[model samples]
Target: MNSKKRAWFVLGITIIINILCQEYFFTEQFINFNPGRHNILYSAPYFVIGGLLYLYRKEIHNWMNIIGGWMLLFCLVLNIGYFLLPISDLLGHSLFPLLIVFTAYHMYALGSDKKWLHNKIIDFLSGISMEIYLCHMVMFRVVERLHLENYISDSNLNYVVTSVLTICLAICFAYCVQRGLDKLLLKKIA
Candidate 1:
């Protein structure tokens, strides 16, 4: 199959798997594995969607330029409805993922061409984003171990402080790891 055909096939399969795992085969083990809405099954479809977006980005960009505003308004209405209305289980299961995709696509489309988003800090953060993801759980644990929550008296203030500290720690750790990997790769290449 062609690349486009293969991408569509994979996208379809992942979407089917996501719906099945979420709606039908959501067993206790699955629930345990995917605590606090961190469902691994959903990742597959989203990854595939991202790939598809990149694959057809030029076409998608043209289409977005034409009707992006209308789509954004539609998404806004759906989002309002989602929050205001008592959604049924089936709709909630389906609509939530759709909303996420729409929101992410709009964000990407809007930000991808912005000159202001091309700053040095943004570039550095983007470079280490994967590393940050890998190290964030450890940084969260470090924050908990340090008892940063109690460092502040007010509950909300403590939460905010700890959250900021955790993010800063995670970013620092990720930057160090990225630098180490770069040096190691450079040595191997040399």
Candidate 2:
């Protein structure tokens, strides 16, 4: 398969997964844990972009300083506004991911050299992020089952612990599932 086509396929699958998860899972779940208006889940797109950029570092690194600086600025502004003003949590968290996805899509889709995107790590993570997105809820349910929230009463501290555990668990589960999938598929071909 061609690199351009493959990238599109990954992007498409990501979009599809987002749509399904939102329609079925998030729509229901959002009501329960309505983090206000910041939409932290939007950050998922950046994780995708960050994974891709890590893989295509040669091409992306050139812009890392410039892009990184602007991203930082944007985040700082959002944080100040989030805390100082009566900004909604959903909007605060939503902004970063929207910025990231826009920046990444522009940087790679229109401007990047197609030849540089065949990096193995990016391709691998891009393919598996969908699964991570899908299974993340299971991990969240586990955390709740353990009553970990009972340990952290301060809202800020609770957010911090939950965020850390969510990311770590998602990565671990995704790695295990992807590795198993690769082995299963490779064995069939071999």
Model 2 residue 101 CA deviation (Å) reads 12
Q: Report the lDDT tens digits of candidate 1 across residue range 96-116.
A: 546474655555554354455
Stretches of model 1 off by over 4 angstroms after superposition: 27-36, 62-82, 85-92, 95-107, 133-170
- What would the TM-score be for candidate 2 when compared with the true structure? 0.47
Measured on C-alpha atoms, candidate 2 has an lDDT of 0.60
Candidate 1: global Cα-lDDT? 0.71
Q: Per-residue alpha-carbon lDDT of model 2 for 59-123, expressed as tens digits?
A: 65566444655644555665565467653565543344454445545454333434555678667
Clashes of 2: 9
Model 2 clash pairs are 36-90, 37-89, 37-90, 37-91, 38-89, 38-90, 38-91, 38-94, 39-90
